[model samples]
Target: MKRLLVYLWTAPTTLVGLWLAPLALLTGGGVQRIDGVIEIHGGIVRRLLRRCTLLKGGASAMTLGHVVLGQDRTVLELTRAHERVHVRQAERWGPLFIPAYLLASLVALLRGKNAYFDNPFEREAYKRAP
Candidate 1:
């Protein structure tokens, strides 16, 4: 099936994203499938989003392959559209998504742009969903 191929193509990246699932679960976070993606929130997901990213106050939600990590359930709901854009991007980029994403950020930084906001991927997501 075409869908199966897409899943397989993205599986490597998805596995990288899933690295945090158990940690999230053990730390009091939660996980559920929504619209064919895993959405995770609370516990360590909360702490990571609040402390570990490039944003001043941290991101409300982040998508890695088919996984979306959020500060909470409400944040997940609010950012679902935005994060879904990233999921589609992952489908397009396949296993190369992370490296390509990081490269895009680096390119933005080198060009004197805000890495997060100016990265074309983020730009696309914001344009489509914001």
Candidate 2:
């Protein structure tokens, strides 16, 4: 099951090009290929190239190995730590963690906290980033 989900998560951007994917670039850093997966700071994002209808604002999307974030305004802006955090969360929780992560993220947003900062997963990514 983990392998299947990993395959699904990585199929989109891996098949294409990392540059062409919906990756967030840090101020002085960018995506890097590591031993296991593409490591963006402490966050591990899956790459897949597919015809997706979940993108918003533009023709490109940077989803976190899921079908959500489609047409999401936040997803519109490509931030390094923002998306990277989701990657780490997915890594620790596996594929079934999206729903819980999304809920927590939304609650944090409603509380007027920065999603990328207040989010536990994102917090980890940011803390571990160089």
Candidate 3:
């Protein structure tokens, strides 16, 4: 089934996400299953998020495998569609997703482009986001 395929495809990254679940909880965030996706919200992630200047005013939620981590409930709702596309990308790339994404961004930056906006993954997600 498609669901099984997706689960298997993203299993590696999902495992990583599961490991971070406790940290999410510790930050006053909780996890939920929504439309077959694992959503993690709240906690110290928001405070820590501010440290990532690259994400300033841009990223509200990020998807790692089937898990989506958000700054808050409102941000989660707003970015759900965008993050879902990233879930699919993670399924497609498996454990290679992170490194590949970073490489893409680095290449973009070296070429004097906006790393996030020029990265193929973000472009794909943006195209599919509402």
Q: State which candidate has the highest lDDT.
A: 1
lDDT of all predictions: 0.92, 0.44, 0.81
**TM-score of every candidate relative to the true structure:** 0.96, 0.39, 0.87
The superposed Cα distance between candidate 3 and the true structure at residue 38, in angstroms, equals 0.9
| Lowest lDDT 10-residue stretch of candidate 1 | 12-21
Clashing residue pairs in candidate 3, if any?
A: 27-43
Query: Candidate 3: misplaced stretches above 4 Å?
Result: none
- Which one wins on TM-score? 1
Q: Compose the digit string of candidate 1's lDDT tens values, residues 59-92.
A: 8999888899999999999999999999999999
lDDT of residue 84 for candidate 1:
99
The per-residue C-alpha lDDT of model 2 at residue 19 equals 43
Candidate 2 residue 91 C-alpha distance from true site, Å: 2.9
Off by over 4 Å in 1: none
Q: Which residue pairs clash in candidate 1?
A: none
Q: For residues 22-60, could you state the per-residue lDDT of candidate 2 as single tens digits?
A: 452432223444334453321122222123322222322
Query: 54-100, model 3: which lDDT tens digit per residue?
Result: 66564577787988878888888899989999998998998888888
Quick one: ranking by TM-score, best first? 1, 3, 2
